[model samples]
Target chain A: MQKGEAFKIEVNELALEVTSHIVNSSEIFRIVFSDTRPPLVVIESLTNGRPFWTSVPQGRQKEAEFFGKLIEEKLKK
Target chain B: MCYYNGQKVSKTEFLKLLQLEKALKDFDFLNKELSTGFDYSLNAVVRPKEGEIDFDIVQMEWGFVPAYIRNREQLGKMRLGYKDSAGKFHPPLTTLNSTAEEMLKPGKIYREAALKRRCLVLSSGFFEWRHVNPLSKKTGLPLKATINYPYHITIKEHEYFYMAGIWQPFIDTQTGETVDTFAIVTTKANPLMEQIHNSKKRMPTILPDELAYEWIFGELSEERIQQIGSYQYDYREMDACTISKEFRASLDPTAPFAYEDLPAFELSL
Candidate 1:
């Protein structure tokens, strides 16, 4: 915890560098998957202090549901 | 920076502390088992409800933000370090841990807040790094190696505890926005911490629940506040264990990791 440290994580074989930053006065986690064919952008928030996706840009909403269900669970495990 | 866990704080227990049945709706709750203070992450803290003797459990940023900081731009510049007109770079002041002794001193950043904005940082356990120097294999003598052994320290049986803290209400001058931020107050380490957080030889003022209630709710003088701010928890009533170096990436960062060559210390009485 060095004041703005980034986290490295994987989701569906995609490596992501996640950093928490203030967004609209609340903290949010964001990642950009350059490895993807179109380069995906995924953003998430914690509700009731649990992680849930809030943004999956470029029409990936349908596929994002799969990742959103358990990011927090995956983190705790 | 401090790293701590904040999971499994009994809801009923927390409500009882605040005497509130249904406050804290939509709170970030600091529910993460492991969170990094470096991220300026939100964590649960108990503070006096505005104009009320009752307490409130709320989430505030872990890093202390001085009221003089005008905006988010200044905050970023301060944390990241900014150069002046002459190209001199000013490093960020460490906000993660404020020394209790100096908080009330004149012109200190924590002075005003420490006077009127005391709080309790709720924590399950906290992480610290110990500097362990190993011997050089070729010479079989001591080597100047920077080896940091991570440890998770907690109360003997309590699932959660509180650390003395001070908060400030920061206003973004440009936008007129505001947020409450705080820093964990640190005092000289007790014997146990002397062996664990060896680098700084300091530890957070981990107050017991009784003192926690007094910290946020009791009315006291400047001397009393300073006394509580520098209060040290008994080391014998605490526990410590080395954890995986790559704990941040691990599911259970607090899980004990035994070191083969780690020197064992006789618990300081």
Candidate 2:
């Protein structure tokens, strides 16, 4: 993303395009949000050093609990 | 002057940044989202026992408060350190932008912090405004009023910018909680800011990327500190476009003032 320009939704697509740019060169860009209905999300890997994405179950109480469980489960590995 | 949610922001933006609800809320959910790198701590970074720097994440309060006040009397004796309200301490030291001059003063609160407790304030932008008219002298009608005219500017950018600052470790002798507080640093405005700030002054000295580490730990020498004034960033490169009055309305609910295409206020000698 350019310094002065504001972020727009379409420009924020996951796939890379020739003209697209990331804001401020942040090494880690994680976008975690909740969507109730499924197409249960998944990620394989990256083509370049681009942004990383993730999705988890969404809820007020459930979101936090799920996040904690995910971390604990990951740590067990 | 600008507004957020229709209210004037004379009280300063520190509290708004530190609020837990706001901090936890993601950027896409809000009108703006500031990136304060993962390591950025807005509050106290709990030091690991045995004096080891854990680098573990912890948040901090947005503003600096010295760690020693135990009672009302102790808080009362603390200097409120604003250039304007130097001798008086009525409003108390809630939030403030510090100064390079104050940091160098032999026995000032800032000087001591500069030597031992330097800190970095994180933000994406700040607000400064140009005063068109003075507010009522008696009523203190608007914060925009009292500032030195022509040079006085007001800002309400719906954005964020990291400000250079310092912190002190405040230990509660009673509760035994060790909390850390901080202050922002202000310097003479750059040329462009001089035009908008109108008075050749801007608060919260902005540091460059290269100087980040040096500024935090390097020797507080006369030559090194002078760079803040002599070598400030180019103020002109940052452009100023008229922000929408609707945005202004959201910022100052009480003002209910509409945006007018009046001539820009000029600096008078």
- Candidate whose lDDT is highest: 1
For all candidates, state DockQ relative to the true structure.
Answer: 0.02, 0.06
Per-residue C-alpha lDDT of model 2 across residues B104-169, encoded as one tens digit per residue: 676666666666655555454544555455446698664453432222122243233335666666
lDDT of 1 by residue, B1-269 (tens): 11111222333333332322112232245446786798988888888886764566777988899877889999988888889999999998769889988888899999888888999887878999988888787998878877888999989866567799999888888999878899999999999999888878899998876667677767778888888889999998999999999999999999999999887774646
Total backbone clashes of model 1? 2
- Compared with the true structure, all predictions reach lDDT values of 0.72, 0.42
Compared with the true structure, model 1 gives a TM-score of: 0.70
Per-model TM-score, in order, reads 0.70, 0.49
> Candidate 2 DockQ category?
incorrect
Fnat, model 2, is 0.00
